[model samples]
Target: MSGNIASLRKEFFQLKKDLLSSILSVGISLILFPFLLGMENSLKGPIFSYIEAFIMYAIFSLPYLILIGVPVHIVSRVATKNMKTYKWVTSFFLHVIPALLIGYFLFKNTLFFLGSTVVISVIFFSVGYLLNSIGASKRQKLIIALLPFILWLLILIPTILTETTNKALMNEPNPEVEVLVNETSFKPRPSFCWNSDGSAGCFEDKEPFLLPIDPIGEEIQTNGDVTVKVLLHNTERSYTIEAYYFDEENSIQKVTGDPHSFTLPQHIQEQAVKVIATMDSSKKGSFFIPIRTGNR
Candidate 1:
């Protein structure tokens, strides 16, 4: 009876050890997955803040590790399992295939994801093997496994600096497609555009002039008379607008119209004009609109 009890206790301890090791491997792999993989383009967006990105990354990786990654990790850890025979078979079916498909939707490069998973798997399982096989104190084992993460952090610092330096170097804008519209303090550059009536916005050369900030309404461009109505709606929401027409000598004439119902005077006809405006609404933004005369 004493002998049987000893055997049972020893078996229970071994099982517990294996379970804890497996859990640690899974947890560490999921956490490291995103960081090791360079996924800036896929993760980046105006809508995604840092907290949201971290939460999303965790949510995305959790289920996958639970379903496939954990299983393979445990099976590979089993003493009876020959890693040489199972490496490709398990990795291809359980890790690579699913990861590639998921990456197709989540990332720009599918192969990149596969490579990341491969690296993660190698690091993860390799650490687990070291932890289990090596006879050392628990503290010593933790330090051993943590070496890889420490190395990764060291590499990450220089990569970030390089990316920042590259972005700073690319300070110039596309001169062929975009032009600056600044002139002076009292008088600025004039603009001319049309209503989005079938042709969308009226063009200067070919492509329609686009406002950097979006409009309150669906249509960006409005005509001489139509813009007056737009100003009325925008002003009610605490928007300030300045409308003026420019003569051939670049002298600008301010179009002082009522915020409720503005109308362009007949005298200010047959020339290009613009309105610079800013709004303080739910979607607080600013833009410039140009109205072409004699056309629309």
Candidate 2:
């Protein structure tokens, strides 16, 4: 009786160690999966904006032990517990297939509703059913084996229906237009022409314009716009042109430019900066002549 008790204690410790190891392995794998994969385009919007993307990425990106990784881990965890070879194999496979399917759904953007809660529950049920139904008749084992899948389907069907119904009603919006300002010249020249006379007088009676400080930095502002103008060489027609201010966060802040004049906030005035906006690929060579308060 003493010998049997000691052996049972040893087996119990081994099983406990294995379980812990398997769980840890799965966790680490899931954590590393996203960083390893390039999935920027997989999410509907910015990855940061989408909750589904966050959860789905987590579900799929995990290490091998977490999903398919867990099954083999289970075998290792229970190896010393007198677990039969058939039972070990069955246990590993039953948990593994569902995990793989779940991971696949994440990768394929199909896991719209099957959340982490459902996934964890399925894994628990599979492990319990596999262990409990072992040594039972083949028919009983088969039924037990099917339980997780059936539960997954049941959980998934309603989730999918709700997601579909919700989307149909209040559909997600298109991605925010990523407006990029690709100005041909960062420090653009004034549109005014110089007078031929040596009096340094302006010709063509043009409004005075000011050169903007680099929106990116606090480089000292240039007082006067340059007179030298580059020739237009692009074949494309009209491009949507706008001015933007690069805030401290490095995001574009659009600036309103009206006929030779730019009205900026007090902060922008103090910084002496403006952004020249460019439309998408369609617009090629757009230019703006901005004005300073004194230059008018």
Cα-based lDDT for every prediction: 0.47, 0.42
Across 1-296, the per-residue lDDT of candidate 2 in tens digits comes to 99999999977875675576556545533443332232333546646634444467666445433545556445444542456556545555555566557666654454533343334434444445555443578787776566555655665576567657555433322111221112223344323222222214432221222344434332232233322122222223222334544343445466443422343432222233333322222212233433232321
**Candidate 2 local accuracy as lDDT?**
0.42
Model 1, 136-198: lDDT tens per residue? 677766765665566566656766786675454344221111112221112223332223232
Off by over 4 Å in 2: 1-115, 131-133, 166-296
- Per candidate, the number of residue pairs that clash is 2, 14
Error of 1 at 128 (Å): 1.7
Relative to the unseen true structure, what is the C-alpha lDDT of residue 220 in candidate 2, on a scale of 0 to 100? Answer: 33
Off by over 4 Å in 1: 1-12, 33-51, 79-112, 136-147, 150-165, 172-296
Residue 90 CA displacement from its true place in model 1, Å: 13
Candidate 1 clash pair list:
193-290, 196-200
Alpha-carbon shift of residue 12 in model 1 (angstroms): 4.6
